[model samples]
Target: MIQKQLYFNNNMRQLIKSCKLGRDWKKNRNFHSYKAVQEDAKILVQPMHDSETRELSFKKNSNVLIQDGLLRFHSKDIKNNF
Candidate 1:
């Protein structure tokens, strides 16, 4: 449980900071097939709705705050930004 929260917290912090800087995050890129994609910076992350706290990475550069497992976002469409 601690590890889970730690991962969540760490990712959350990254997300918030990225939002402030105007970055977009990506998750599950299957980089094995595309080596070039690995060079991209990570920007945002969230637990995919279908998973049990597994992260679905995102790419958005802006300030986002997550409190008590809830997120406050500034972007409209994160996928487009990535």
Candidate 2:
């Protein structure tokens, strides 16, 4: 395996190395209507799209749905929410 070296002992570098890199809304900022806004789209959009399985949106800590019409449910236990 190829090893990568870190240039600085920072929090961001640590997160990236762990394969758990994510955006922190508190530190980063963006512009709004002629001014800087406190609202962050990353809070809702980025993590929700990236972390879960493809082509589906689920609520916080919710179970993955299994429909009787889908083939994927045949292999999976329908009772299990995850």
Candidate 3:
């Protein structure tokens, strides 16, 4: 898949930074391992929501934050965005 330029929050930015700092934090390729969020000039991620289901991906540029293994995407009309 192709990845585009994106941003994230401070919390996520720190997470990515720490992951690179050592082997304590590992990266997930499928995007279901962790939650994701998007902000301006934050970090690289892919959390865009599904156009039909509105269910968001936990990918790097995703916006779904995991709250106890739950995927949450706040979108009224996800199709419009897609």
Candidate 4:
């Protein structure tokens, strides 16, 4: 009985370690916004088009939305510019 319990404990520890590592890896691999503005628990993003880079800039109070397991940015400025 003691040996069985030890085996179960070891399996559980390994499972927990693997889960933690997977979560950490996912967090590190994901893209995160640089800054955000929030009001009443709502997020507002202000993105600008970088003329040199030809990509959306997220350096200025840019917030992101995560939908369908993807990061999305929504703004009239972004739509009009791009």
Candidate 4, superposed: residue stretches over 4 Å from native:
1-54, 66-69, 77-80
Model 4 lDDT tens row, 29-53: 2444223332212222222221122
**In candidate 3, which residue pairs clash?**
8-43, 45-60, 45-61, 46-60, 46-61, 46-62, 47-61, 47-62, 47-63
Judged by lDDT, which candidate is best? 1
Report the C-alpha lDDT of model 1 over 1-82, residue by residue, as the tens digit: 2122223423432221112111333323443111113223233334323222222233433334444444433343123332
lDDT of 2 by residue, 1-82 (tens): 1122223332111011112111321222222111112222111111221343312222222222112211111212122222
**Each candidate: RMSD:** 12.5, 17.6, 13.4, 20.2
Off by over 4 Å in 1: 1-49, 52-61, 77-82
By TM-score, is 3 or 4 better?
Answer: 4
Ranking by lDDT: 1, 3, 4, 2
**Candidate 3 residue lDDT tens string, 1-82:** 2122233432231111111111122334545442233222122223333122221123333343333323233442112232
Clashing pairs in 2: none
Q: Where in model 3 is the C-alpha error above 4 Å?
A: 1-62, 80-82
Ranking by TM-score: 1, 4, 3, 2
Q: Which candidate is the best by TM-score?
A: 1
Comparing 1 and 4 on lDDT, the stronger one: 1
Model 4: per-residue Cα lDDT at residue 47: 22
TM-score of candidate 1 to 2 decimals? 0.28
Give the TM-scores of the predictions, in the order they appear. 0.28, 0.15, 0.20, 0.23
Question: How many clashes in each structure?
Answer: 15, 0, 9, 0
